[model samples]
Target: MSAARPARLAVGVVSAGRVGAVLGAALSAIGHRVVATAAVSKASLHRAETLLPGVPVLPPDEVALHADLVLLAVPDDVLPGMVRGLAAAGAFRPGQILVHTAGAHGISVLEPAVEHGVLPLALHPVLTFTGRSEDVQRLTGACIAVTAREDDEVAWSVGEALVLELSAEPVRVPEQARPLYHAALAHGANHLVTLVRDCAELLQREVLVATSTGSTDESMVGSASSTSAERVIGPLLSAALDNALRHGDRALTGPVARGDVGTLRTHLRELDRVDPELADIYRVLARRTAHRAVAGGLLPDHAAAEVRATLEEHR
Candidate 1:
């Protein structure tokens, strides 16, 4: 394949999942044809229709047998067995490009397919996919982690070429580093969602208290203002996220960073009354935040010690 553009190969997506269908659409946009896909779930079938229209839905073996490039976008746990099963079924042929999107795995998991003389590559797009057209658009600036045999420059170039064709940058990741790379991404992206949702839930509770009328349930809060909590916090959260990305540890702020031990105690008591689990989570995160603040010079060691003491006393 050329560095500027990949050849228009016949592509087969092993399954029309959130990641698979959107990637298929990206490949198709760049002149490659999506020949076949396997989709069993209703959502998958709908995604195939929406993102990869005109592509035939076939069994996994048939999809692999018919394509020059096979994209295995299955879950991490399912990928190894699926590759082995396809190789055993004689579906993978010589000269076929076998690719997987599992972030934790490198080309090692493709060993079974490699035994069949197929060129194995791992191309994991770092962004989350929703099996939508917008997801294909998101690929334009997203980073894809490319892992091929360290000895094979041609294979590495091929993976890089494919990512470039989608207008995305490719970062070369060594096989041994794949697990840690994926873990870091998960810790940032996945945990960020959980953290944001927890914050939103807490804000919603306060919204309920501030806006209650004759009724005091959550429905009353919704009736008063459906998006009041989100409206109040969205811009602040967005700015904090942007600042954190741009400034790293220097972006630390709020009561924990200031070592407001009295404020921390009040928060813990309120959270403990409302939800013990949430209180525990807040305590743990606040303790860590205080440490980071101190290390970043936002808080003095004496202040951080006081914050930690307050958290432990609350526990």
Candidate 2:
């Protein structure tokens, strides 16, 4: 695409799912002309109407035909086929900007369209889409990671403009880094769900056992009853995350980070006694933390050596 003049960009959104509808609406609300969308589900159609008001629900090909910018918010696995189909159907107009919102993928999936002279880009918001109206609120003040082909400056500018219109910060990430970035996000948010569920089940079992024994203290019951899992974990995690983000890797403060080898050994012994399967997890995490501490210059060479030795012995 030519980078001379900023085009009066007309936007078309394909796959009117949660992310697509919310963003299409947000773009429309910001005075960008959202020309059309392709919504497959009734709920998606309802969301499209809510967001885009009277915008037409057109076919996928029509979306590409009408707009200068096209967004593909479909499932990740289906994206390549969709782009190839669009390209085969002559849907991509020359210089049209085609962007997808998949975090795990880079702009390479849009290679078919790129060959057709379409500028490929990616704009992934670092937030989950829960298909709730509140998602619109969540879109504001979010961080979106943008990835574009090195040669496509116009597409990059369009991605930045979209972020600005949404009141979100855009960070340019390299194409090869997309998968690792997405894996980090999934490890943090998705794995936390499994971890929290396991904790909740354990707590419930403990509570039931205590109740059956009729030895549960009133104060203990009250504390457990009044504080939810989220209440207990959210603030603590938020503070740790804040420290990690603002103060860098040196902000790590657990036993491993502090080179408290004896404390780590004690914890590993306890885990082996209570849950043998968890011992490996403890060892691995402690080793990782030790590496981080060493990298941050928080641990001396001797201390790092000791930490690694302890973790290896436990493993």
- The numbered model that scores best in lDDT is 1
Q: Write the per-residue lDDT of candidate 1 for residues 60-149, one digit (tens) a residue.
A: 999999999999999999999999999999999899999999999999999999988999999999998877899999999899999999
Global lDDT for candidate 1? 0.91
RMSD of each: 2.6, 3.5
| Backbone clashes in model 2, listed as residue pairs | none
Task: Please identify model 2 stretches exceeding 4 Å from their true place.
Answer: 1-8, 41-46, 187-223, 273-277
Instruction: Write down the lDDT of every candidate, Cα atoms only.
Output: 0.91, 0.82
lDDT of 2 at 269: 89
Candidate 2 C-alpha lDDT tens digits along 145-192:
999877767667867877877888888988999999999999987876
Output the lDDT of residue 67, model 2: 91
Number of clashing pairs per prediction, in order? 0, 0
**Worst 10 contiguous positions by lDDT, candidate 2:** 206-215
User: What ranges in model 1 sit over 4 Å off?
Assistant: 214-224
